[model samples]
Target: MSDSQKPASDPRYPDIRHVAEARRLRSQGALIIDALGGIILCPLDTSRADLRILDSATADGHLLTLIRKQLAHPESAELIGTDIADYPPLDLPENITLEKQDILKPWPEKWEAHFDFVHQRTGLAVTGGMERAVETVRRFIELVKPGGWIQLVDGTLIDHKIAEDDKAWVKLFKVLSQCVTLVGLDTSLGVSTAEILKRAGEGLVRNIGEKQGVSPLGKGASSKELEELGYVELKGMHSGFVTMLKGMPEDKRPTALEQVEGLLPEVLREAQAGECEMRWYAAWGQKI
Candidate 1:
């Protein structure tokens, strides 16, 4: 097929197709929120009845629903969730609206400075590079009113640490990195997000703060509960790696897939030994 006529492929991770993937995304989102200590991390009072909040890349409206429940007056607050594709859950409250929005592009004029708080999780890297990420953050900042806040969350792939050198683990990571890069997903954006936000909102935002944490992978976790959670994340990420591998150019696809398939056993063994861990970053700032 001609390149122009080829079907478009989504570069985003955690393909939301089956019940399992959906559940995984929900669970992952909730865990990150819990680790960060709450749904709304900014200094703003979430209990305020008139607050306006936006959750970008809000698949299935799960986070929005949670935020709605926490509000002092759910009916009075305005909560909107936007994604490039609509997968909204059923029976949503009237005050919560889920609409299809391409966050990488310009939003409607009416949305400018319309929200009291703007949030995005694991979304910006889809822009493919730092420049587009910055552009997207600027738009996010624009969506907030004076003194409103914008927050972001994503993995800092670069900050990951291993207890010992494992050739198989390193090889698999290199292959996965190639796949994400080819798919236009910058997995390292997590650490850079805070700096990007600062650059994106230089004169417009203040009181910027960032937090980081490591989530152990597989059975190497500190506790049974964490071990299970880490396994879930690892599994979901593996699925994404395979999905990206499939999207590679035909000439390069076979070799890369073969390499990843061959390395899985060793990689899993290393993770099970608790030698693998991943890091994430949460950054938030308020508009001046």
Candidate 2:
């Protein structure tokens, strides 16, 4: 159901799967970050009391927190987080409603043109392939009210900045990309969310916008917080790491896997020491 790694056994690890992802997304969501309410709803009549928002495919509900930032009061919004799995304990569990949903199935009839805003990030992994991902985006746009807002965020799996000599991680990244492709998922789909929505949305969506940024990790990092975030992110990719390695040429798989596994600890150290960077992106639009 996901490409990102699940929670690590370490109790102290933050719920963030990738700090680079959280950073770029939070920055893009700042327009409605303060939760002052009615600001984003400015497009609607001020007297309209109903304001509903949804964060589909949420796991830990971080993006839902960003969506909640726009509400003035708990009751002023109907916030829902939808996923096939159980909702994990959120930072503010009481603030939003959680729903059990399988996006591959048809969207509920009640959800049609129902939300004031819809937010999602790095969610296509749930679709298992690009065609279903495209369908999910189409349904996501359709769920928004006319003149409502929506935002989608995703990241590149192979996007990284490392020392010229850091060919090992780069090689691992290529393997990861191939692994994802062999399974029918687009490794770089996150960078294309805006374009996908723009093309599929056509007359239904307007004011389409997208922006991207690069974040430093490890030894190239300017701060410890960023560095730690990078380390955590790399750790989260471990499962995909294993999967990608196993997908390599059968003859080389065993040796390559062993080599990459041994170097990961140092690779993490490289990020903490300011030696690496990751790229992420976001796309948003208004439902017209």
Candidate 3:
């Protein structure tokens, strides 16, 4: 809600290079754009006299793939993507304008209650515990124009059943769970996203719907992509946790990192064998 509450040195916020790779591995390079519900792509009203869409915490604007393919584009559909930095001049379509804003801070007064759709990927936006995440959701609600929709997608929630039969997945997920928990956020955020949004938006958020299914990471098209995403998620977790281990024995830190690095091969092997299936949720609702 205030600038004083902003997170610092967030390793969860990956660089452009990391974002490029991660998005490529997700939703056929649009970062799960395909998973977005019809509320966005199929808006009921055709009167685009003043349509607006907000892509918060958009990294490199890759999620605008659909807009870029618009041959008969909506005359007033404005796709604005915001992030902390432009990061070496992203290549975005004309309809998708790039802006600089950190969602952890208060958004511009002009932006409040003024977007037909507000979309955010949790891995790119909110980090930290429930209180912080709730506030972030509140900000997202603030940006939505009345009768607009807000959709949120969180990373694959850690599932012990998926790891039970695979040692590599077990190891990697263990590290992920520990790191995410340390940051005061639930590992089940992916599965419980609807509740989070409902809690944060209470009176305003309505008609909640959630989509969640197991995506294979082995011997399937989606599985192959999941392999790539898993690698990045694991590496990201390692990077975040290593920083938090500052007071630990210097020798132990590197060793722990090394151990994490070693698990990569197992992730690859298990993924190749189709032993990993990630479950994530895409929860959305209208702001009434």
Candidate 4:
């Protein structure tokens, strides 16, 4: 489908910016350190090397920014950021370049077999189908040079249990998941990464690491800060998702937004109550 034909209210589009910021913070905090260390310890020679990096479905160059700032292989490295629509307004370092392309489509003409590292995060639900999305990712692996790395990070909305069972929060999560699923996407694609990679014929797989934690509610707590930022992002996402649904003949946009608004207070209350927890997963592997 053409970009304009797609609804402006799509949650995938709205969450792009907020998700980028969250990744930026996480990269600077602990994630980047681990990624860099992993790259350094890889079996590749660091000296006299040529590296090309691709950030597939890069929302706002969050991961690219972190890599440019941290990696020492500047001369040998080139970075490309791809997205479905227009690239977000991100200030990238000189080493990075932005390209307007959809991950669902084939790799751009100039990028075939050009990357040494392919990194992507959070696109399973944004793309139209899970298998199609995995196929695109497999094509991304084809674009990488031999003995390269492919890293992916995403989370499922499962197990978002609350101690007190706040109805509002539960309703919101369920509705959000349902809306996205209606478009042929899965919110919980993280659990399937290993299997997808294997299906893509990628070998020498290594389970880098995985992390799980509860999203907090207070400002000082880690998960709380994420929720606060995520709430702000949700306003835009809700508007976008509602707008998309309104375009449908059977969907009612006004009622959707009204329900979303009604749920907000309860979501915020649950956030404050420290009663909810969100689980996340991250992993990486190599192509033989």
Candidate 5:
């Protein structure tokens, strides 16, 4: 359910196997919900009749599933998940539907002001860059009804709390951010979440809210749940790093690959022995 309208061959869109990515998305979704303390923020009234929600970039529809379980009146809600691809888990309740959507493009006119809530997360991989991010948020605003809510979440690479001495772990993340930039995506997506929401909504939304949360990794993990979440995040990032390697020039690719590979063990050790955290930001606004 990642958001990439680009062709599957696009280097920016890592070719992770569906099974692996699905696992990552599920874990990430759980982590986000845990961080936020709920699936729907923005002061939603979930019991409203015919409530509607859209999860953009809804890879594997994991988030929608979570919503379904948590909603006060799940059966009354119109739950929709959209992504570049159309594969939805068969177990999704009848209330939930998955569709193929390229959020970078204009959406259907019928969808304008249609949902009660719109959600997007981890979209820097395909949102192009900072400018495109604003556009994407604007699109999300257009999809919700008047007085409805739109929420955005993303990882703030390098905007995290790590021990000053954890140089190896820090270096690994720096390289990862560089790889994302090399692939033409914005590494600053996370920190820019609030700004993007504000810029995009302009006069269209009100009461914009923003917050940041940490997903602990390795030994910095405060609980077993967070420890596992860290590992899941690390695995997903490693896969993305390898995929980005293919886009590099022949001369640089090998060295970059070796460097990442060599860093894994030491980084893993550091993570398990000490504290590491992935910082994330979420912003939301109610459409006026």
Candidate 6:
């Protein structure tokens, strides 16, 4: 269907709850190493006792937990997290406070270069425009004290081949990518982040670490777990795409959801089979 004619009630994108549930499954050993890596970058000192942290699109605060676990004084670092939706129904740590705001706009008047560190994940692709999103990141970096850190964790939806290829999986990827673009977002991180940072005048973009993995059902004990995790991660992607499509004319809604729904079972079956694998990318850099 043409972008202009799509409906407004297409399924909603997955929320923090869904994303958190996926993380929970992964924590339970659902072969989600890639998810884990994307959530928390390694080479982190965790011991840096005093840090001002800002988690953008902090859905359910899963990444917060991961960072807290890795840091030395989880209780001591100051944190401010924001999301476009109402803050997810997750408890904030004593050290962290939640704010509801749009990151694409100017930084809040109350927050003035107060952070020592800033972290954002997943929201880059949801923010509508790459240039605007990168500008937001630039603002985030501006909020941090010089010599502080700015870490970003995100993934692209582009699929890479493993041992086997399924037409269903391929079709699913294409539809989802289209759905994302329809909303003015890009699903591929490898395609944009560095350029975004550079365009924003971010200095010395160093790759702290990188990882890639597949989401399948039974490749190992971890495979089934990954499937459960996919439900969460993909739910967010699905919701975001649907929200964008829903903005279109009403008649085209069903066709879009049908395209999405039709692929879910096959994707689920692959997850269950544990034989297919998809690529997930991750990277982190410091603001010098």
Highest TM-score model number: 5
lDDT tens digits, residues 158-184, model 3?
A: 534334454776666766565555444
The reply for model 2, stretches above 4 Å from the true place, is: 1-50, 125-132, 159-166, 220-222, 243-256
Model 6: lDDT to the true structure: 0.56
The true-versus-predicted C-alpha distance at residue 212 of model 6, in Å, is 4.9
Query: Can you give the lDDT of residue 173 in candidate 6?
Result: 61
Q: What TM-score, over all chains together, does every model reach? A: 0.84, 0.73, 0.75, 0.73, 0.88, 0.73
| Residue 34 lDDT (model 6) | 50
Cα lDDT of model 2 by residue, 127-188, tens digit? 55566677888888888888887777666677343345755556556555555555445657
Candidate 5, 42-63: lDDT as tens digits: 7877767788899998887878
Compared with the true structure, model 2 gives a TM-score of 0.73
Candidate 6 accuracy as TM-score: 0.73
- Clash count per candidate: 0, 13, 3, 4, 5, 12
> lDDT: which candidate is best?
5
Write one digit per residue (lDDT tens) for candidate 1, span 98-214: 887888778989999999989998887788789889988999999999989899888755424422454665655555665566556787777787889999989999999988766
**Candidate 4: segments with Cα more than 4 A from true spot:** 1-50, 127-130, 158-166, 202-220, 223-240, 245-256
| Positional deviation of residue 117's Cα in model 3 after best superposition, in angstroms | 0.5
Model 2 lDDT at residue 41:
27
Query: Against the unseen true structure, what C-alpha lDDT does each candidate score?
Result: 0.74, 0.60, 0.60, 0.56, 0.76, 0.56
Note the residue pairs that clash in candidate 3.
216-223, 217-223, 218-274
Candidate 6, residues 49-114, lDDT tens digits: the string is: 876778877745555666676667878887777765542256657777777666767887566667
